[model samples]
Target: MSGGSKLWGGRFQKPTHELVDQLNASLPFDRRLARHDILGSLAHVTMLARQGIVPLEDARAIAQGLRVILQEIQEERFVFRLADEDIHLSVERRLRELIGPAAGRLHTARSRNDQVALDFRLWMREAILEVGEGIVETSQALLDLANEHRDVVLPGYTHLQRAQPLLLAHHLHAYVAMLARDLARLQELYRRVNRSPLGSGALAGVPYPIDRAFVAELLAMDGILENSIDAVSARDFALEFLADLAIVMAHLSRLAEELVLWSSSEFGFIEFDDAFATGSSIMPQKKNPDVAELLRGKSGRVFGHLMGLLTVVKGLPLAYNKDLQEDKEGVFDALDTVALLLRVLPPMLRTLRIDRGRMHTAAEQGFTLATDVADALVRAGVPFRDAHEAVGRLVAYCIAEGKTFGELAADELVRFHPRLAEIVFPRTVWDAVRAREHPGGTGPEHVARALEASRSELERTARWLQQERQRIDEAFARLLSEEFP
Candidate 1:
């Protein structure tokens, strides 16, 4: 069977094949842009009327019709037709039905090329802020956890072997630092995504006296995309978003990996809340850290989306292509996945029980205080390299005799270096941690200051999100108002 495209069949003598319709239609996925499409159209139609390209009365009618459609979609009353091909046409077809011929004038100075580009950028502008909020929430959660466990010390590892002792607060602060960078990346990317491309038309600039700047203002965009061709063609904003999302997932996956390890029977440093853990069907005693495992596993999923978009975009020709349609779903999924992780992770972290005794014991078991002992020798006028070599031999001697440094007699210690007989070794984990009182160190006073600074940073990011959200909401509220001139 063959049929003409309901919205674009004027020149076709014969209709498209049914198979082509299924292959060509983007209504299923691109329909996610319905709200964004209406919002963009509202701005475009208002601009058209101001420039005298569309009659004022007709612009008012089109704006009314778009508001109705927006409400329909919001309330789940709108129908999506595959024959309409995409969100742009679906809204157009419905607008025509609602207000007759005036709806047609709404698109007078725009084409689906620039229209979709506008909708996508609008969508991303909102999404970037939303992701920023998530990052803030996650960072705040980590900071809260660090504050709650400020006195605990744990073995910090390199190459999976315990190498040094650190405050657990310092370890959690590392993730907070990574998330702050993720938030910064989104804030930077927002500037690029905030430009309007609506008046670019198909490829070359529209012939009408369209005011791109006014449309951008109406939509709360920062400015117009300067080049008409680039306006409809550029997708680097989305690529950058995906790239930032991949980094976010990488940070989250690291935290999740640590959670999984810490909750295990062998490590026993923490326990997941029952709500965040799962029980096995066959194993009677298996309480699995499934949520953490899933969080860790989903990082690759986001990474794959980033790679997929890059590959799709690498060889694209100038202007627009149907190939550009491949961009949305990956972005949608990646954002949704990151949002879900942020929502669940904070609660999971807040509920987990920390075994401070286990962490402190582990901190002491790994010869973690050796560096502090070597430093003590350096303070006694022994060269650092000599101090390190002497400490290394002392460790070997303790291992051979099946004794710890605390168990070594003064006679035994003096065999390595005469100064070792007089040096008071740091046998407790607190001794090692308290010795590092410099800024950004694992010392109690420094961790306390860092926690306060991190909390302040998180508060600033939250305020930024709230203000940006208000700006966008006010723009849409004005666009949806009944009084359109």
Candidate 2:
């Protein structure tokens, strides 16, 4: 064994093995956290100065040095090193080389354990805000689409078979409901992630008479992670985040699958914008829903990333371990996937052409009004089960005769049950759609009310996201400013 940097090697007899160095390095992916690492270092060093743990002059020098590195990274001028293993070491390595022995004091009372944890939380806080905004904007787009097509009625499906009639706004609003819950999950996760883990030091708490609250406040976090071992070892925040992302992506995939189905000639419920669709290489006639299809496919990776991270943390014991290094890559992948899909989808949806005529035609053909007819029978004193049975028999008879519900004459209805003849069935598709008058029903009046409610929810969600962003911005300003209060 031979020559390695003396930074962490005072006790070692040999240089780190070349293969091990390459294998252990996270620089390829985690170099993106350089600014976050420096931000964490700045907070830590500022705390050190505040508490007189390090000389004021040395703390000032370290602070300025870390700020300079942060600027370099932002400008894409910083040189990342594989030998440094990860961002924390790389920043400290560069700091030592930049500011001489003053840089040596930068690590005082801090370990890469808690330092990296703080940096990661900072990064994910911003990430959550960003992804939350994406979810909000996506919901807003759905609201806009629903608002645009308020009167369009489409077939609602069960087991991929048209089972009832629903307004297109109702369908779009269903996704908005799912996305609203997703946004709520992201908001909750942000609070969980916003707690600072910096003062936990390595595994045991640092013994420098340092104030964890001071550092946490400076970082604009909720509070400190009280247990040192849990502070550095816990990755449930990442798991929770991935879980949120996977669910959102699953929702997106469902919408995407519908888009794929709807854009086809067979369904023709929607048509993709030219920019949002693709053509086949072999068949010039083929206009494929590739973008929507791809988003649907992308859910696999988000799902895989969630499972990957869950597996990584499942058996790990308390306190930090190198196994924890397995965490960020999966998280990063899921975050990137979610962010990209959300960004592309809103615009694509805004430009899509809804085929109101096709949707209306499909809704009418499905015997969706059978429920309305059954309900009508119930109103006419047919027992509820008998009404359902009566409707089922009527539908089977119509299918056997190659006729629709609309084709059955009033006189023909008496054969199913006398109650069927007594009831006034809706004559046209619109008549059938309008007959289902109930709150949250696909009736035009109800869908309009739902649309307004979704609009209100979208506005509220947007405001909530803006407040979250403002809080982060204000915190960063405090962290970067000369005043520590």
Candidate 3:
């Protein structure tokens, strides 16, 4: 159908070509939002009848028809037609088919502009909650892994070279920190997405006595949007959501990359469980970290989705535009990508094997205790810069002699710095790993303290997630009672 000769056909004479209809249709992707569109229509129709814009009987029939359609959709029995351009048009056309003229009254005071705005906001509000829950689940998995491996020593790296020794729990908790920030961002996005934009018809307030706040409450929204133009034009929630997804994906990609590297024979710091790995076709010994690699690869796709939506919305003159139709695909893709990662990553992480012996051996070989040695010199009254330079020369001499810094004999240490004494050198590798006792240092005591702090953070995050989920569930229940009961 032509844009004008379709459902809203009032000003045009010609029919749209089949090719044009297929090209412009969003029903293929946006059908996922069908339930939200129907819910919004039900609320709008009820508000219309209460305002005397539509008869009460018509509103009742329209609501019944919508309820039937929702059931069919939930059961996967509803047929989606390409003739309808998007979910809004598809559901309205179906309503008309079911309830005849009563369906016509359902759109009396609403425009597709504000109607779509409301539908998208409602969908995103729910999606943000789901994404937040998924993040929390993944965070819990990381915390569990951290708790299991709190004492496993690993080499921490800077510039891809060993910098110090650290507990594996500390490394895993870094991701938990990133995910915590992601959760906070999603919560803030929920605050913005919770506003209702139902009364902003097209680009202006509708000429009806409908109560916007009543519809907002029926939808369980935090508030009604204030400005008609801003309401219809606002897509900041979508952008914010995509941006947060991009950031979380970046963190995931970093973790994935490390997993890939650590699983290599050169590192041998970790091994993937058979379920999360794949064997090469020709190489019998090749069990690959394909899951981690795929996770890393998918990060680019999510980022591309974010940039695609950003490009689509960057310069559009608002109310709504044909260009905005491009918005759903990217948002849906980004949501799918994040949801899939959230579901898959925790299982993969939980199953992976940590080669703690290899990690410890690597940590021991890198002279990761050089910083502790430098600090020891500092404590012995040497200025920090002087100690650092002295350590640097000692490290160079050790490398030239094919030795670790720990191999320097107490008497041999005097060759590099004559002020050194026989009691200066650490007697054991583990002693070297534990010598720097400063707070937040990688010393044994500090690592234990860090582990405790991480455990406390994990508990706090779990409590927050539980409370947030309960709050959302209560809001959804209130919406159900107000709108459906």
Best-fitting candidate, scored by TM-score:
1
Which stretches in model 2 have alpha-carbon errors above 4 Å? Answer: 1-6, 482-485
Candidate 2 per-residue lDDT over residues 1-485, each given as its tens digit? 01244347568777777898887787898887887787777788888898989999888888878877888888988888787878878888888888998998888898888887888899999889889888888888898999899888888999999988877888999998899889888888988999998878788887888989988887778899889989999999999989999999899999999999999889999889999998999999999999999999999999999899889989988788788888899899888888988899899999999989889889888688888888888888778999999889999999899998767887878888987766786766677677766986768888888778877877887887788778777877766666531
Q: What are the Cα lDDT values of the candidates?
A: 0.90, 0.84, 0.81
Highest lDDT among the candidates is held by which one?
1
In model 3, what lDDT does residue 175 have?
87
lDDT of 3: 0.81
The 10-residue segment of model 3 with minimum total lDDT is 1-10
Give model 3's TM-score versus the native structure: 0.93
The reply for model 1, stretches above 4 Å from the true place, is 1-6
Instruction: Please provide, for model 1 over 333-361, each residue's C-alpha lDDT reduced to its tens digit, 9 standing for 90 to 100.
Output: 99999999999998999998999999999
- Which one wins by lDDT: 2 or 3? 2
TM-score of each: 0.97, 0.96, 0.93
